[model samples]
Target: MRAAKSAYPLTWRIMDALEAFAAFVWPARFGRAIPWLMLAPALLLVGLLVLGLWLIGDASLRTLDTSTFLMSETYTLANYRRAFTESLFAVVAWRSLAGSLMVTAATLILAFPYAYVMVRTSSPVIRKLLLIALFLPFFIGQVVRAYGWLIILGNQGMVNEALSLVGIAPIRLLYNYWAVLFGLVQYMLPFAVLMLAPALTAIPEELEAAAGSLGADWLRTFRHVVLPLARPGLVGAGLVVLTLSLTDFAMPAILGGGSQDFIANAIYDQFFRTSDQGLGSTLALLLVATGSLLVGLVFTLFGAGTLAMGRARQ
Candidate 1:
């Protein structure tokens, strides 16, 4: 046995030594705890999050005493009421909700085809190029991307310059709702494509070929087969895009040029701009609740498959 151990490769010997040390430190009887032990960090993080939320909730119940520039001792729902009643807050909320829906729809529509081609295409070069394009923007910061759009869509930018050569005037493309939405869509496309790719890959090409052999057209095959199989990815991507867009700040701030603002921007204005921590806490809590409710709705309607694999089996 010693000779046999000595004959093993150096890498294997090291692995054996590590295993032996681990077994000695942690006995086999406690093996079941290993899973829970590994989860300790996550549990700690969740506990901290809950603690922070509790503190915020407590703060939200109190009102900011503007006269003294401090929070009041008595609890009140005034902050919550103000959030819903204020026209500025209401408009920002509506804009965020509307923008989120629009961005989600556009992202899914644009991403589905890109992801489908990336997964289904036989050409490695095209796949590589597509992957490169998708990930290249992902490496760049969202703030940087917003600034890039400003350069490209500005009055003196490349787009307007090209139009000038054709005897057209520079259009007001930047600093609007559409501009903010465009920035969000551009930022989210990669994430949507990434989420959808695995789902598309899971679909067997042989199924499509089989459908074709049975005289079904490509569109019919895709509608009846591929689309159904890819629902999990679609739902997941939609949820991700919706939540992100709803809470986005940088795009609206940078691209919308002070006129357009999302819910996150509103939250920021409360906390920092106006120095109203109570209102900020209320907004933050509401945003969390809204996101949680939306996610719960998706899960309730679509099952866990909206965020996981195994939807096809269901």
Candidate 2:
């Protein structure tokens, strides 16, 4: 019995010694570095993006020679000039900017109520139903959703068939700017709701109740109390929706019928259709700048509405 007890203690001692040796060898002693370690993947991603941007920036300074189907070996500002001066580029850029803004606004408006209800609702069944509804689209994928819209909105599809039953002629729903916007709004709704849900969840319900107790109506309580607290989520969600909408290619491609093109569509046409890497790179860099500017503006204006969710208390 004494020998067995001694063996157990000796085994524990050996395990402890191995652990100490491993810790010493690895030397991950810096508690401060844990945060940096957590951020390593993000930092790596950003670094790759920076490298890609640098390459694009270099490419943007060159012009494509249509005759030779080759880029100019020497640098030039012709691509940038063309981006601003060309009517096609201008129209596409304007459409993308306008669509992104509109989609962001619409998504936020729709998502807020949905997120609020999802967070505040007492019934498990309703919450589950809402979650299922939101998540169902995720499995279907963006391309599929866009295609689903195509099927539903096609001349002979369900929507047109339903309209024909009412004695109305089949309306052209797909292959237009409005169709692209509708698809974008539908696609972005779930993302916005997901972002807003956590922010809504963070707000204490007691604050709303207290406001009501202090002679505030439901509307006033929402406007004054809940809205202010939910700003972080709203800002985060809006930024995500805005950036995504601005860069979206598929919806515009499928729904726009090649006429109502967004910036991404234009970029694709420049790169793939025309094989003009110089112009594509220029447009890509410009998009990055535009998106960065928007994010900078938001961060500058509202310091309260940070992207970080439940940041470390320290």
Q: What's the lDDT for all of these models? A: 0.92, 0.91
RMSD of each: 3.0, 2.6
Q: Provide the clash count, candidate 2.
A: 0
In terms of lDDT, model 2 sits at 0.91
What are the per-residue Cα lDDT tens digits for candidate 2 across 1-314?
Answer: 35777656877989999989988876766766878889999999999989999999999999888899988999999999999999988888899999999999999999999999999999999999999999999998899999999899999989999999999999999999999999999999999999999889999999999999999999999999999888988888999999999999999989989888888888888899999999999999999899889888887786425475456222
28: Cα error in model 1, Å: 4.6
Candidate 1 similarity to native, TM-score = 0.91
Error of 2 at 211 (Å): 1.7
Off by over 4 Å in 2: 1-14, 20-24, 27-40, 304-306, 310-314
Q: Candidate 1 at residue 241, lDDT?
A: 91
Who wins the lDDT comparison? 1
